[model samples]
Target: MKYDFDYLIVGSGFGGSVSALRLAEKGYSVGVMEMGCRWETDTLPKTSWNIRRWMWKPWVGLRGFFNIRLFRHVMVLHGNAVGGGSITYANTLLVPKDSVWRDGSWSGLEDWESVMPGHFNTAKRMLGVTENRIMGPADILLKEAAEECGRGDSFYRTQVGVFFGDEGEVQGKRYPDPYFDGQGPERNSCIGCGGCMVGCRYNAKNSLDKNYLYLAERRGAQVFEETRVINIKPLNGGEGEQGYEVTTQSSRLFGGLLRKRRWRVRGVVVSASSLGTQELLFKLRDKGSLPNISDQLGRRVRTNAESLIGVRLPGDPEMDKGIAIGSGFYLDEHTHIEATRYPRGSDAIGFLLTALARGQPGYRRIFTWLRTLLKLLLTKPLLAAPLLLPFNMARQTLIFLCMQTLEGHIDLRYQRRWYWPFSKTLQSFGPKIPTFIPQANEFAFNMARRIGGLAGSVITEVLFDIPVTAHCMGGAAMGKTAEDGVIDSRGRVFGYQNLYVCDGAMLGANLGVNPSLTITALSEHTMSHIPPKQAA
Candidate 1:
């Protein structure tokens, strides 16, 4: 029987993009349904001159998509573009520690730590991962501190997916693909605009749009943007068989101007982000759109236990003018910190660094940062006046990004309470996440202290403050038991056939660094279970 392509993809992030490319490569007709637009990187906004215009969001509208807000711990940054989060994230890619892989419930499924190397190698090759070739003052200073504390060996530059130009050429110069062997489009060098966190205007960032998704679209994947899937159901029946009915709402046209649209497909893969995929699955399960979904719907959610803290260079004031996450410090076996940056002259959206004290619910890290600001204000006129100068703040501020492989997770469940009776109180929030304690990550704070850089408090509760996560994982984890898993070891839905989850959501534990590699690797592994897409 004919279907809408060979498979349907729910999101356009790393996992979805990889599956799209691989499936399309084998001549399968694929449809990738993304909730955002195809943001053109060639002319994307950069610099403080146009940051508000650079960020992206979907809930509040296109304008709100880009002009995102950052709290002390959690910085709500997501891309409302066809390429998803890759469109806006800094390319500081680092694989998680082996320790993280060992703790997950599915750790025994396969030799995750050993067998994943080949997949990771392929991901690196595909992503153009390389040691950061450019060094700025912030990185150099951080290295100095790390070396002084005897952790210099651990402070090498990150393997970022940036394209630095030919010798002596400025970073923005457009040149042929440095690693593509003339196979792909010309690549522009990184101008180091620090806008990567917003969106890379330089075309230097290896965002999936330029690589995997680009090639996938070229091969045969049909990509739809600004199309949010409102509901999903097994058309043949909710049982393990046949086509699917995908109901969607277009964000492009006005509400009344358009009507709900539906499509049919044989197989479906959920790759929307942790929050997105979780909500989509929850809706399908709760509203009975797809009632066969597992009872463990929102289990194993992770935040990477991350935080961001900023440090100002002693004398240099413009240190925030580099790549968004240029350098970092690894304090110990568990705690990792990076020096994240924003373009110069942008709004002072301060830094984050973690393992901090967790506060009472409803009164979180954001409130704490507010309190800190209030304390500073209250003290400025009395004692700390001299330190309140703009120069001191800029120079002394060290944007610290704290991360750990320590494991903790949240499960997504319905609040079931109505907001306005008509409003969707079906909100997705953490279930009173466990408190973040600093003592567990003290080796890292001590490393910073040894270098004279003070511990950047959470500005809020640890889970809420210093929050830095590019790869949010596991709401639908893979396991052998429904009591423990959502997707099986083969990525198939626990009780159903032809449904799979091949993204970060499948990971059962927190990865300490950028999780794109692991997601790509997992996607590749899952694709092996899916035979080459049948031709139309």
Candidate 2:
């Protein structure tokens, strides 16, 4: 069968970008479809408060880069852009603990400890990993808090993807072709603007579009931005044997009026993050486009077991003078917390955090919320008053991104609920994951006590038993067979050929750190399995 392209990649983030570059370099025609818009450095939002350019809800006419998708059990924060999550991510790239490789469906499938190092090294080189140059007040406070918790030895600077310039004279200066020797774009050193999460406008952050997607385009790969894939059907009644018939529609505000377009491809790589891959596959399977998808499609969904905690200081102290995520400390073997921040005047995220509460789901959580609010009102009335007032959150707050390597996850299923009586949507299923982690709260309380500030957490975790996670992983996990998982250890769907999943959806274990680097390394490993395109 003649194909329009050798490979069709969905989502232009870490996984899709890597696939497009490697496949196109191997002489295959590659096309990447991204539902988000292309973002240039100068065009990025000045701050998260710029909702029209910082938040995404196209139908409501807010076409931004960040998406906050709320499920019953979890609220997922992710990026939507040509560079994927890299556009809005904090740029910290740390490898997970060795124990992470031993857990989950993919465990024992390969000798991961021995083989992953090489791929990780290649990914690091391409991403331009560097040691953080500026350590702001937030990093110092984290160290002090670690000492208060008797874990001071565990505090360390994070390895980030930001350029910090050559080791000598000046910092935050522009440099020419540092990583790829003129093949990649020129970069400026990080000015410690704390704007990485708001979209790095200084050209300091090593986003994928500056590296992988840029190289892929130079190799003749095509990227279709603002095009969302709607349907994927196996052609000639067989998956991959006769290629695929792919259909997509515009994702703009006027998408409903736009006619859908169709294409054909010899293979499809679904790298649309974890949530996206699960939703798309669920729709296709239910619609009978690909009927052989495994029953384990939406199982083992991990969220890094995360919590966002913070402490608000009354005085301005320049907390936003460092990188978005500058440093971290491990509370214990399983719990890790990083000092996170936004640029000055970027206070939109502050609205999502509230006073910390501890309890299980249901009525007990509501009781805990009331008790915590009462404690704040009685003991720290001065701090409680500011919660109702307008303040410079970035200049006076220290944000903590807390995560756990503990293997706790919630499952997702597609259903038509009563609230939304229209189309089927993804819903959280099964037991509720823990909304409050004791170690994280203890650390936050200790930090607030030390600094005489107010400690807080996400309000959704208290009121609705939902934790916010930036790293949503593992819905189409890798297993030995179809009965056990959706895809094989090699990332190919079971009972199907030439159909692959190489994104966060394939992650069986949650990395305690950011999952971007792991996703890139895993994509590199998956793409290496396929041979170069055969000469006609």
Candidate 3:
């Protein structure tokens, strides 16, 4: 049968980019449909204060990379761009503990311990992962806090995907393609600007566009930017045995007419993030576009059991002077904490922060917050005033991103909201995830007290009992059968031929650390199962 390409991949993220490159190398034509704009160093925003160029809220006319999605149980921070979350993520890449292979739906499905190390090594090498070379005030503060808490032994520099050049050489010096032997784009050494999240204007960050997606395009893969897939249906029909027809439309809200386009491909790879893949599959199943999709589509969605807590120092100490997350330490066997920061002048996120109030969830937390605020105002007005204000926030604040390996999950469903009855959308369902981590809060409080600063937390955590996480994963996990999960161990969607999901959605376990490396490794494993075009 004739088709537009050998395979059509949705979402040009860590998983999608890897699949594109490997498949193309195997002599397959590939098409990547990404619902985000392509970004370059010159076009990157100077600071997150440039809302239109830094945030991704298309409905409100703001279209950039970073995105925030609020759910009933958690606030999810993700990204939307050609390179996906890698453009905004901290670039901290660490391999999860081997115990993860024994947990979740994917347990016992494969010999993960024996197989994953090679893939992880390959992913690390491709991403240019190395020990962080620069450490600033924020890292020192983290180390001090860890020592104060008697956990200094766990403090260590993060392994990141940045080019630092020679240790003694000048920073920000341009160099020819270092990783790919001049086959890739030229890169500059990191200048320790702490602007990774705002987007790396220095070209030092190892974003997918500089690696996997770059190699894929060079291998004849076509990337269609700002193209959103709306529907997918198997052609000539019995569970995609023949080919598939994919329908897409412009992702811009007001770009032009709502014209739709179609593409036919022999296979399809849904590599959208966890939330995105679940939402799209739910809509397709409910609308009868691909009704054979497993009923376990949105089950077991994990958020890495994460929380956002921090400290706010009054005066400028140049806390935001290094990479976004340059160092971290383990508070205990299960919990991990990383010192996070933004570039100076990118203080918009401070509006969502307030004095950390430790108490029970719900009304009690609010009451405690009020009392804490009043006591600070009355006892130390000078310190309270500056800590509460949003000015100089990036320069004066230190964020603690805490995540746990402990298991917790929520289910996502496509349903109509009580307020909006006109149409149905993706909604979170299940027990509320923990909004407060007592140990993390206590550490923040002690750190603030010792440093003469103020403990802080996301305002939503205190007011609405909702925690925030940037590492949302799972939902569409791997399992042994169609009744148990949506996909198999190799990422092939159950009950469908030539269809796969190779993204965070396919991650069956909750990786305590960042999930980017795992996703890349798993995608590599998935691609290994496919034979080359000649063999086919």
Candidate 4:
């Protein structure tokens, strides 16, 4: 059937961006709907303190990119801009260990070790991947932490998606379409301001708009920013044999008064990140638009067993001047720790970091928090002062983003509660995940002691037994059958044709590293399976 476009992709992140470019290259007409506004280099927030332009609280008149969703089990940090999480993600992009493929729902489906490298290579080239260029005092301190822990050899520079030009100098020079041979946007050298997480105002970080989406737009793929898909139904009670109808609305203030727009498409791609995709699919399933969705829709949601800890070294010269994630060290085969930072004055996130404490789950954790706070105040008042008072914490702090490959997960569902009486809010339904990883806390303490600084962590971990995760994955996982999973091995939904889920939600295992590269490679593989659009 002839339709307005051959494909309609939801969310323009690592997955949707790649899908847009590749399917357009395959001669398919594509349209992408993103819920956030397009950000350009000149318009990005200079620091996290620019609250109106740096936070994603739309109800309060802030239409920023970064979003922080609170669940019973975790606080999920994600992005909502045109480039998705890439707008706020630290540029660190590392592949997980081989054992990651041997576990999870998709295990034994194929030899992923053999299948992923070529796609990864392609993704890396397109992203302009390179070794981290500026390793400042934070990296040196991490090396010292590794040495103190007797694992010095395991420390190394991170592989990232930032462009560090020739001789690693910030020449302020422009290179014409470095990755796509004149098809993509020009880029500049990184100035090492450690602002990748806050958004790259320098055009140095290789966000999706600079590469895949840039080329896709050039190839005639239309992108609708500040728009959200409200519903998707198979055409005339048939799945893809005819086509699909997609309905979208603007998310801007008073934009709801405008009529919702409807478009017909031959196929659909669900590339929203795990949380966003799951929430949208749950609504669709309940609304009876897609009744055949698998019951395993919200199971096995993984968070890399993550822990965010840090050591604040006050008066340390030039500590916040490096790349966002410059270096990392492995404490063991399962545990990885990276030195993370934000640019000076980007202290909006500093409120989330507190004194580290060991504790069990539940109310006991609150007591542990109080006790730890008392101890820090009594023993190290000078070090604890800024953590309690207002100061430039980002400039003086060395953050450790520690992740474990150990298998642990949670389930998310939509349900109504007393506070959310009007609508079903996202909630966690499962056993309590451990709030503290002793190995991670030990590493933080050691780093603090070695540097003569104060050890810190996320306050929620101590007070409420909830861990924070930036790399939320899984949910709409792939499996061998519909009874076992929501989608099939190639991201195709079990009960539908020409429909796919190709984002972090499709990841089956705890990657123990940032999952952006994996998501991109997997989406590349998913789109490679579809034949080019036939002539109308």
Candidate with top lDDT is: 3
What is the lDDT of every predicted structure here?
A: 0.67, 0.89, 0.92, 0.88
Per-residue lDDT of candidate 1, residues 1-536 (tens digit) = 66666688888888889889888887777899887777776556544345345544444344313434342224434555677778767787777777766788677887888877777888888888887776766677678767876778888678887777777876578887666577667888887656676677668889888788888988879998877888878876655487677787776536513867777777788888766777788888878877777888877777777644443334444566667778776777777767666665444344323222224434455565456456645754332232333333433455666777777765666444453654332243554433343533354345445544434443334434234444567878877787788888767887666788877788877787877777887888888777875544
**Which should have the higher TM-score, number 2 or number 3?**
3
lDDT for each residue of candidate 4 in 394-513, tens digit (9 for 90 to 100): 788988998899999999987788866988867897977777778888888877887788888888887778899999999999899988789887889988888899899999889989
Reference-based TM-score, model 3: 0.98
Candidate 3 lowest-lDDT run of ten:
251-260
Looking at candidate 4, the ten consecutive residues that score lowest on lDDT are: 168-177
**lDDT accuracy of residue 6 in candidate 4:** 89
Higher-TM-score candidate of 1 and 3 = 3
**Cα-based lDDT at residue 63, candidate 2:** 85
Which run of 10 residues does model 2 get worst, by summed lDDT? 382-391
| Tens digits of lDDT, candidate 3, 1-536 | 78999999999999999999999999999999999999999999998889999999877888899999998889999999999899999999999999999999999999999999999999999999999989999999999888878899999999999999877899999999999989999999999999999889999999999999999999999999988899999997668988899999888886525767999999999998988899999988988888989988889999999988888887788989999999999999999999999999998888888899978898788999999999999998987877677778899998999999999999988999999999998888999899978999999998988888889999989888999999989889999998889999999998889999999999888899999999999999999999899855
Each candidate's TM vs. the true structure?
A: 0.85, 0.97, 0.98, 0.97
Local distance difference test, candidate 4: 0.88
Cα lDDT of model 2 by residue, 340-432, tens digit = 999998889878877776666677878877888888889878787675443578888899999899888889998899988899999998778
Backbone clash pairs for candidate 4 read none
